[model samples]
Every structure is written in C-alpha cells, then in structure tokens.
Target: MIKLKELSRLYNINKTIVEYGLIELLPRQHRPFSYTLMRIVLFWVRTKHQHLSLPERLRLSLQSLGPIYIKLGQMLSTRRDLLPPIYADQLAYLQDNVPPFCGELAIKQIESSLGKTIDELFENFDATALASASIAQVHTATLREDNREVVIKVIRPEIEKTIQADIQLMKWLAQLMQRFLKDSERLRPVEVVYEYEKTIIDELDLMREGANAIQLRRNFLGSKLLYVPEIYSDYCTKNVLVMERIYGIPVSDIDALEAQGTDLKLLAERGVETFFTQVFRDSFFHADMHPGNVFVSYDHPEDPLWIGIDCGIVGTLNNEDKRYLAENFLAFFNRDYRQVAQLHIDSGWVPEDTPLEEFEFAIRAVCEPIFEKPLSEISFAAVLINLFNTARRYNMKVQPQLVLLQKTLLYIEGLGRQLYPQLDLWDTAKPFLEDWMKEQVSPTNLLKKLQQKAPFWLEKLPDLPELVYHNLASGKSLQKQQKQLIVSITKQQQKNSKSYFYIGIAATLTLVSTLAYLQTDKNLAMIAGIPGLFAWFLAWRHTNNE
Candidate 1:
C-alpha cells in the first residue's frame, strides 16, 4: 500500500525534475509519446533555470532535492564511464554540506553508545559542531586521558529512515527509467542507484569508517606523502566515531597554501604519487579524496604532507587488478594503443571476440590527439574518459570495482590542475609503474612469496609421504577400473554386432519372400514366407535378449 506521504513526495520529486527541465536533456527521438503527454499535462511547471546549462540544472536539482540526492550526485560524479565529462564535472561540484542536527541529541546518542556521560569521556567537549556533512557531524573535544584534541563524529539522528525513504523513491524512478527510457541500459540507472545505496548505508556505520581510517593510518605510518588521522577505537561505536583532530590547511584553500609558501608543484606531484602508492603498493586506497576530506599540513610548506579523513569508503585491488592497471598505465604512457586494447581483452574487461584491429583503431583515434600536445598539457582523467567512451561503443560494460578508483583519479587530477597545471602526470607515474612492474616479476619477489608459504609447507611435511602413498594407491585403483570398463565396453559391442547380424539375415529372408510372392508359384511363396517369419522371430528374440 502506498502512503499519502510517499505519494506526495513522489509528486514533488517529479515536479522538481520537470521544473529543472531534465526531460528536455533527453534526445527528441528517444522521448516516448507518453513523456510528451505528461509534459503537456504539467505545462504550468515550466523550467525555472533557463540560463543554466543542462549539467548545472542537474546538479542544482539534485542539490535542492536533499542530502541523499546530493550524495547520489557526488557518487555519479565519479562515474565518467557512465556519464559525459561535462555532466561529471558539474556533479563533482556537488557538496555533501548539510545543516547539522541538534547537539543535545548528539550528546545523548554518544552517551548511550559509550554507556557513559560526556564528562567521563572527555574534557572541554564543544556542544557546537566543528563541521557537518550529510552522514555525520563532528564535534571538537579534548581527551581526558592525555588531553589530546580529537573530534567526535556522530551519525545523524533518524538518518536511516530518511535514507530508506529516499532510496526507495530513487529505486522506483530508476526502474521507470529502465523501463521507459531509450538507451537507458548504457546509463544503468538501477545499478547506479544500488551502488549509491550501498555507499550511503556504509557511511551510516561509523565503526566501519573508524576501522578503515585505522587501516589507512597504519599503511601510511611514518610516511611523508600522506597522513591518516589516528582513530580512537575505545570511544567509537556503530553510530559514533572519535578520532585525533588534525590541524591543516584545507587542500582547496589555494590562497592559504600559497601564503604559506607551499611547494605547489611538488605537492601536486606527490598527490599523484600517493594515489598510485596506495593503489599499487598498499592495494588499499582512500577512494573518497574530494577536497572536503583532504587537508594540507602546515609544518612543511616546502614538502607538504596530506592529512586524509573520513575513510568510510576505500578501494582494494587484488594482484591481477594491480598488474593489469600498471600495464595499462605504462602502455598509455608509451602511446601503445594496441597494447591497451589487447590488455582490456586479456583482462576480460571487453568481449573476447572484439576485433583487435578495430578496437586498436578506435583507441588510437581517441588517444592520438591527446599526445599531440606536451604530456604536461594533457589530462590523464580526460584520456580515461575518452577511452571509456570509445570502449562503450564496443559494448564494454562499466567495471563497478574500478568506479571508486576512477573517481579518486578524477579528484587527484582536479587537485593537480588546481595546485599546478603543468604537473606532468605521465612523468610522475611512468617510472613508478615501470619499477613496480619490474618488482612484480623480480627474483626477490619470488623469494618473498616462497618465504610466505614456508611455514605452511613445513607444517605439511609429515603428511607428504602419506599423501604420496595414497596418490599411488589411487592411481593403481584407477588403472584397474579403466581395464574393467574397457572389458565391459567390448562385451556390449559384441552383443550389438550379433544383433545386427540377426537383423541383416531377417531382412534378406523378407526380401526373398516378397520376390517369391510376386512369382506365379504359390508353394515357393509359402516356403519363403515361413522362413522369413522364423528369421524375423529369431532377430527379435536375439535383440531383446541382448
């Protein structure tokens, strides 16, 4: 049963979409008659933002809708494989900023989660929110034990119900798009919505976020390029998180960084390096590197350090994903479009039957112009977008696992551009990838792998002789079974041959009887017919017996 509230909400969503002229963004040829009729019926809900571009309109519409939609837009912004560069660019501007919930309520929730009052946990706890986002708000406090400054993150009150309601509506709309819209399969509305749902729901669990932060902090411990805030797990819960508060210039604050004499070029290059290190070296990366979650340290303006927070979302690549990615990147660096296409095929990212020549040609066409200019002038993200767009024509589906990586790459590229436009991404990444690739196949790596397995091998040494004996006994038994099976098959073949011989004889007798019947002599016909009947009976009996 549909509630009145839900129905009203659905109508409002439709009204907002219509007023934003989102339907007009669709091609005229693709629009169904029913869509035209609906627009005609809702003629009074004219587009209010006629001056804005389609992409701008979309961003604004999602922003106006609410935090869930804003988060959806943010997630979609990373999907260059699914959307155009322009729309994705606009969506990247969608902020997660939302008004904070009540501080009193947050305190109560925290006390309930930790089973203690605010005073027992900390000193100088601020009731006012230090920062607020869609999922949670942060409150600054000093730990009672060591007087360490920390931020208490609490999930929004009743956010689950809001998320569920909005997600259900979004799912319903996605289904409508899947059913009614042309070429909607390429967009994959339902899958995108489901992905957004999972991301948002995961963000609701602050414990997972805290754990992710801890893992990331461990990975970057004593490192120069990036720093993750320490998670205070003792005071954390599913709905609340406590972590060391970091003081750094916001990565987006270019003016402040410049005022502080930050090495912008090195900073930009280091950003790319850090991203690759997380992906290839660590295999676990902070997927959300949006400006809000990233900060620049003040201590070293010459060699700036990055402070990462809000590790609710992270991406991991297995050995295969890392290998293929490194190879593909190196191939791109070398302008080897054929290798790129072949890698995609080998990785099963594209169809096996895809023509190598045609794919290579498509890639070269899309990538050749990119190399015409200096490498520093090129956009790695743009190159990826073109490659993905071309691959889509060849029926390449979007890789869901790579969505976070792709999004992070975009964030990195944007940061690079903002920090230092001439930072050559290729130059920074090529040697790293080449060196990593070499390390993967080196003798040292082989030794390391063997050493990793040494303990397991030693544990199984006592069983080796028993395993060998069992294997030999099983082989002998298998051979005996094979010989017996061959004998059985031979007996069946002989029986078939005997039955066939009887059938041939019966056929010959029947033919002779027909010939005799056609003759004028009745005694000859009678003698032949009796023999034919006896032969037929013998054949039937023999066949049935076999």
Candidate 2:
C-alpha cells in the first residue's frame, strides 16, 4: 500500500525527472498527471536550460534528488545498449561528491557512538574531511594508542529517515509499474528496488561494511592484480568505522595513470580478470565498484594493480547459479546458441513450453551481429542488454540475485573501456570461464569436497552396524507381510473367478430360453426359463458365499 505522503513524494520525483528532459522515458498515458504537469513545468523551465543537453540535466537532477537517485544514475551510465551513446558517456562522469557535514557534528557523532572523547581515541584528528559522499564522510586520524594512520568514517546524521521515506516512494512507484505496465514483469521493478533498499541500508552500518572489507582483503591477500585495505575492527561500530587509510591514484584519473607510465591495456585487462576471479574463484566480489570506490596502486605501473575500497555491498552465488553462469558464458563464447537456449529451459530461466527452435533462433539473431566485429570491438554491455531483451520474449523471470553482479560487471566494463578502448573482453574472460568450469568437475575439487565432509561421515560411522542390523530385521518383517498380502490377494482372485464362471452359466441359460421363445415352442421355452432361473440362483449363491 502507498501512503499519501509517499505518493506525493513520487509525484515530486516524477516532476523532477520531467524537468530534467526525461519525460519521454515515462509512460505518459499511464501517468496523466505527469503528462499534463510536465507540459506546464517544461514551459517554465525550458528557457533557463535550453542550451544544456538532456544528459547534463539528468545528472544534475539525480544529484539534487539525493543519494538514491545518484546511485541509480551511476548504474545507468554503463548501460550502453539501453541509452544513446552520448547519454551513457555523459552519465559516466556523474560524480558522487556531496557537501560534508560540519566537522563538529562528526566529532559529536563519533564521541557519542563510541562513548569516548575525540582526544581519548585519536592522537591527531583532522577537522576537515578527506572525502565526502552521499552516505558518509572520511576524516584522517591517528590512533592514540599506537600513532597508526587510519581514517574515521561517520554515517551522515539522521540519514535513515530520509532513506526510509524515499524507499517507500520507490516501492510505491515499482508497484505502480508492475501493476499497470505490460513489460514491467520482465523488469521486476519491485524486486529491483528491494535489492537496492537492502544494499543502501546495509551501507549505513559501518561495522558490517568493515567486516566486508576485512573478508575481501583476506580473499585477495598478497595478490598483485587487486588490493583490499585492512580494517581496524577494534575501533569500529555500527555508525563509525575506522580503517587503514590508503594513498593511490583514483581509477578515473587516466591522465595521472598515463603520466606514471602505467600500462593502459594491461590495467584494463586486469580489471576484467579481477572481476572473474572474485565471482568464479572466490564467490565473493565487491558489488559497489564505481570509479570513486576504486584506485590504482602507485607502486606497480608496468604490471598495473587495482585497489578496491567501499566494501559496503558484496555478492555471492550459490553452486547452481555458479555452474549455470559458467556454462552459459562458455556456450556464448563458443557461439552455441542452441545450447544456450536449451540451458535456459533446463535452468528454468524460461518456461519449458517455450519453443526451442524459436528461442534458439532469437538468441542467434541477438548474438550473431556482435560476432561480426572483432572481439576487441564488441561491447559486452550492449550484448547483455540485447540478450536480456530477447529473452524477455520467452518470459525469463527477473533474476534478483544476479542484479549486483550485473551492475558490477557494467561498472568494470565501462571502466575498462575508458582505460583501454581496444580491450578484448571475450579474450580476457574465455580462458577464465573455461578454467573455472574445469575446476568444478575436476578430480581434485571432488576430493576436496569429500575431504571437507569427511568429519561428518566419521561421526556417523559408529552407528552403521546398528543401522545395518535394524535394516536386516526390517527386511525380514517386510518379507513376511508381503507373503500374507499375497495370500489374501490370491484368495480374493479365486472367489472372483468362481463368480465369473457362474455368471457365464446364467448367461448361456438365458440365451437358450430366448431361442426357444423365438421358435414359438411354448412348452420348450417354459422349460428353458426354469434352467435360466436355476443358473441365476446359483450365480447369486456363489457371489453371496464369496
């Protein structure tokens, strides 16, 4: 249910979207108020922004709407297939920068949450924020106990209320879309918003974020392709997180990277490799990987490395999804459209009743065009969108679990293209997928699985003899019961056979009587009727006896 307040907020949001020259994207017929009100808003607002492009206005409008919209805009910037190239390009530069809360308020928050004064906790705390974002601000500080350099991250004051209100509004809008729009089922608008809600809310808990960071750092321990910073857990809380402060070039600053003689192609390819390694090898990945949260290590310019930060959101896949995804990627790489179609039906992604040939043809049509270009020139994001749209025809259910993976891939791909235009995504990903698939079915992995479960098997081994004895006793008892049942069934069958015999005799006598009557022999017909009556009595007697 949508409250009046939420509806009003949605109306305001729609108005803002229209003012940003995105009214055409709205279902004008479904939203009559927006359609009419947009015309009026456009009339007044057109004069001031006639010179600005739609993409610029879109970025500005999203930033003004606050954190949630900014996040949505950032995700949309990588969707090269859904939007025009110019729009995607412009949105790619949408910044997450926001004004930081006052330093005094941040101090007050840290003191209250940690139950200690700033002086007690820090040897030297900077009043100014090192970085500010929609959710939190980071300030450089030194630990009083050890004089170690760290950054204190504080959640924005009273941010929960604002987020909650907007979340409600988004839910209402998603419901409206799913209810009224014919194509919204494939989009799964409500589930998408719910996923976004969970992610953003989790971001508020600095402790959980810290744990995520620690786990990711452990996963990539001593790796050269990517680096995750350590978390200082002793000083962390739900609202305040303290962690090792890192210094590196922002991933977006390509000029600085080039100036440092970083290998651009190697850097781009490494980004893709990092994503695959996280998802397939470790099953844990940094879900929020926009340029702002990523940096390049300054130490390795020739063999470039990535430094990941902002581990607020992470994604994991179950075994089934992992296998299916790996198989699908391999199939796609091999250009086996029929196998891809079959996999979709087998995996229950599409309905079983869907025509296989037609589905295969549709997939081929969507995937074939991309292969015309060299693998280096093909856009992975565009291919994904085309495949998704094509699958919508066969009624593929929206996969909510893969949402984060999709978003992260988009970010990585977009970033990769920016770093190196000729990066061959297929070439980078094919061998990785092949290796992952092989590892899944390898003897070593099977042995490892058994080894991991050996303890439980050993624990149950002592009871095996008793289990076997009981099983033997039960089998003997079942045999006796079966024999008794067979006897009863046999007796019943004999009684039915006797009844059928008597019935046959009665039928013959009746037929004889009818023949005698037809011959006009009255005496003979009366005699035959007496036997027919006798046979009927015998049949009834046999049935009664049984």
Model 2 over residues 329-442: C-alpha lDDT tens digits? 899999999999999999888889999999999999999989998998888888988998998898998888999998899888888887898888899999989988888889
Residue 305 miss distance in model 1 (angstroms)? 0.6
- In model 2, which regions exceed 4 Å deviation? 18-33, 37-53, 78-94, 183-186, 468-546
Q: Which ten residues in a row have the lowest lDDT in candidate 1?
A: 74-83
10 residues in a row with least lDDT, candidate 2: 41-50
Candidate 1 lDDT tens digits, 1-546: 445656667777878878998887779899778767768777888889989999999988987776777766776665554579899778867644556789999999999999999999999999999888767889999999999999999988887887787888878878888899764665677887888788778888999999899899999999999999989899999999999999999877789999999999999999999999999999999988877788999997998999999999888988898999999999988989899999999998888999999999999999999899998988877787788789888777667677778878887877777788788989999999999999999999999999999999999999999999999999999999999999999988888788788778778877877888788667777787787788778778877883
Q: Give the TM-score of candidate 2.
A: 0.83
| The candidate that achieves the highest TM-score relative to the unseen native structure | 1
Cα error, residue 397 of model 1, in Å, equals 3.5
Model 2: how large is the Cα RMSD against the reference? 5.5
